[model samples]
Target: RIIEGYDGLGIVSTIDPGQGLVVVWVTPDTQDEVTHILHFFPRALNY
Candidate 1:
């Protein structure tokens, strides 16, 4: 929901729910911003 709040920032997609795998796609212009925002999230296994 937090990422959803930002317009055109990025999107989080579930790749494998069972393994808790996901992907985040961010706009080139918003890469830095997205990186900053992502810093707040808990680090995932093998990330």
Candidate 2:
């Protein structure tokens, strides 16, 4: 939800709901922006 809020940034999908696993498909040229956003998120992402 948070990642998707950023336009042209990325789209997140659930890989395993039970394990809280998900994937973020980021757009080309937006890696830095996405990484920055993820860094400040409340929940830590397992990259």
**Could you tell me every candidate's TM-score relative to the true structure?**
0.70, 0.83
Give the per-residue lDDT digits (tens) of candidate 1, residues 1-47: 66788978988798999987777788779889977877787764333
Worst 10 residues of 2 by lDDT: 2-11
Tens digits of per-residue lDDT for model 2, 10-43: 8789999999899998766988899898899897
RMSD of 2: 1.2
Which candidate wins on TM-score?
2
lDDT of each: 0.77, 0.85
Residue 18 local lDDT, model 2: 100
lDDT of 1 at 2: 63
User: What CA RMSD would you report for each candidate?
Assistant: 2.2, 1.2
> Candidate 2: what lDDT?
0.85
Candidate 2 lDDT score at position 36: 91
